[model samples]
Target: MSYVGWMIFGVVLLVIEILTPTFFFLWFSIAAFLSGILAMFGLNLGWQVSVFAVASTLLVIFTRPIAKKIMGEAPRKVYVEELKNGVATVVQDIDSSKGTGIVKISGENWRALSVDPKKVIKKGEEVVIERIEGTTVYVRPIETEAKKEGEEI
Candidate 1:
């Protein structure tokens, strides 16, 4: 192709790369621009293709890691532990032996269960929210510790 033709192709590809916002076409556009430069210098088809390939490969391989570092790592979603504790209301009777229940905390309902198997809690009883296991909240009877401090047992 003529020098002018190659330059026009390069410019079109570069514009397309900009519109698409992907780094992929940008490399090929750079290659095409280099090919156009080679054409302007009287290089033939075989030499132009070789230069474009080598330059594009080197640009991608050298720049990818640097680009990743500059962009930084993708932000991860916050875990459930980040939310406040001690504010959940029992939505279902938590049977420790049955191992199933639900609670509503911060306007979001969550599956819940007693962490201890021996404690049997009734419905409408306020409980302390404990650690999360998967999507379930593991709970214990509230004031149990305080009650224990006052009594012998």
Candidate 2:
């Protein structure tokens, strides 16, 4: 292809890199730009393609690790087990039969279910996380002194 064609291909690859940044295509785009430069200097098709392949491989090998370190690690996965026994406030009434509830714990909201499905946990009440199954937390109401005394009675 002509130098113009290679340049246009480079630009297209660069646009793709910007849209879905995985650091993989950026190297190829740089290689494409390099190939375009070689084409401008009157290199034939075989030489341009060989240069593109070698340049892309070298860029990925030498630069990808540095780029990743500069960008930082991917987002950490939050495990529900870590939040076990943590206190949460009911944001929506929990009724297992109706499959409806929301709770706020440590500034994040999560779907919740009562440990005792028959017991309806009201909004604004505090609960202790008993366990988590999948994305929904199973919680039991926090036992207050008044409730303990009432229970004894």
> Pick by lDDT: which candidate is best?
2
Best by TM-score: 2
lDDT by residue (37-90, candidate 1, tens digit) is 999999999999898889889888888677668768856654687643675678
Clashes of each: 0, 0
Relative to the unseen true structure, what is the C-alpha lDDT of residue 40 in candidate 1, on a scale of 0 to 100?
A: 90
Cα RMSD (Å) per model? 10.9, 5.2
Residue 62's lDDT within candidate 2 is 99
Task: Point out where model 1 deviates above 4 Å.
Answer: 74-153
Model 2 gets an lDDT of 0.94
User: Tens digit of lDDT per residue, candidate 2, span 1-153?
Assistant: 999999999999999999995898999999999999999999999999999999999999999999999889987777777899999999999999899999998888999999898999999999999999888999999999999999999
What's model 2's lDDT at 30? 95
**Lowest summed lDDT over 10 consecutive residues: which window, candidate 2?**
73-82
- Clashing pairs for model 1 are none
